[model samples]
Target: MDIHGRQLQSAKQHQVFVNFRGDELRFGFVSHLVEALQRHQINVFIDKLERIGEDLTNLFVRIEESTIALVIFSRRYTESRWCLDELVKINQLTDQGLLKVIPIFFKVEPVTVKQLRGAFGDQFRDREWEYRCDKPRTERWRDALASVSCKIGLTFEKKSNESEFVKIIVKEVKKMVQPQENYVVVPFPGIRRRRDTSSHGRQCQEEQVVLSRESAVLVQENSKIANQIAVVSMRYMDIESENSVIRAQLGELSERLQSLNSIIEVVEGVVGKVPEIPEFLMNPWQIMSTSSQPITASADMFYYP
Candidate 1:
């Protein structure tokens, strides 16, 4: 299959499709959110990891396959045509009732997104007219943004605890997608919400949080590698067991063929003629199914001359 085909197949069907500006949050909040979602066994689709030089249509496929789409509206999110295009597709699917959308106001207000006034809007509006020549596409983007901003969503303000915020978002995600009886994020009693009163204080706290989150990601990846190793070991053991069975069966067939050869030799010496065994009779295991049952060679399997 071609590269596109392989990518589509591997993308699979996820429960959540995350739409975000890659350059901004590829390694920060997005990573934390994805990790938390995965811990709950909620599959997510993040395009930045797999995007190949403006291969944009495949993302639409991911949107259709997903049951829910999380639109993370950061300051510059609307600036990218890709993000705008995705919102359009998401809006289409959501209108059809084929998909659910959860907008995330990441330091960007919903009113600004709906009204096209803030940094997000400025970035989108300031794009070269040459790039926005397609009036229909631009109109679709405007409608999508205006409509999506009206949905109920989570807002990430300045002073919230990053880790706890992730849990809360994940909890909401779980409730929306899974619909369990009780969806909750247990609080960290000891840890206080980061004080973003001053830029210096916020910077120090953010740096500390970033370090801890990176460490957590490393531990998670290592644990996954270890589990994969265990699975490979189990698969190897299964193959070895099958090999042992094959060898034992071959040995048994060898002994039976020797016995038949001796009988044939005796008969030839007495009557100058010997029975001929069929190929399948000589190698009965060739017709044996892969099941544990063995194929026993029998005299009736051959004809006497």
Candidate 2:
């Protein structure tokens, strides 16, 4: 995949926009995050360039155009005046429902961002004093932070490993954006042709092509089904052959048992002992059909047939 081309397309396509301070995170955490997102085909616009006063308009346009914004609030995040300005614009887009903001508190507590405490508080104080002349403008930045801090977002703690934290972030981003490649879209030949049709003559020709393509597809599908049936039939034949062998073995064992019984009866007769013959050997069907006493051998019994 052409990552640079896709990133450019994404800038116009407005997939996901990332807002972060370059000084603290550009070479480290934010760079890794952008790379991970891009690997998944999730186009990202990482804010790595310096934001000049003249470029603020274009920057705001980019933020407004995006569908989702990722604002990484790091320790030195509040220190950048331009970063604060971007945050306010992002918040504005979020409030208007035009954009979705996902805040990432990197090694900083959400409350610290909300209340402007900890290192963030100290930086904001310095900026407040630096821009003390413009109290209202500074106040807007503080409000933006507070509002963004209250939002639901991912957090990377100081004790947590960066690589694992990035994976979790990417997973969450995937859930939110749900990249197109993750889904299967089966297009109908006719409908697809209709979409590509430019003129009446072209439409008719395309329709013919679509019909032929659909016919070929249907034939292929049927061939697959027939092959599957053939495989199943072969398996069934093998099972039937195995069953025939088992039955033949059982028949041989039954014949051997009958012969052994006949020899024992002959020995009993020679010894002047009458041996009882089971009714089943004589007539098993009769025993099943009628509820009567089974016929047995007696000393006077004789067969003259």
RMSD of 2: 26.9
What are the per-residue Cα lDDT tens digits for candidate 2 across 1-305? 25643454455556688888889999999899889988998878865542655566577777766778899999998789989998989877665446677899999987777656678878987998999999888867866776677667988899999999999988888877775443322244434222333587566666666776677567546644543454355346548879999999999999999999999889888986765798686887766557667667886677565
Give the alpha carbon lDDT tens digit for every residue of 10-124 in model 1: 5548889999999998899999999999999998989965657877788898897888899999898966888989998988876554677888988777666665665776787
Off-target runs (Cα >4 Å) in candidate 2 are: 1-12, 49-56, 179-305
lDDT, residue 169, candidate 2: 85
Q: Which stretches of candidate 1 lie over 4 Å from their true place?
A: 1-12, 49-54, 179-305
For each candidate, give its TM-score against the true structure: 0.53, 0.53
Candidate 2 local distance difference test against the native: 0.75
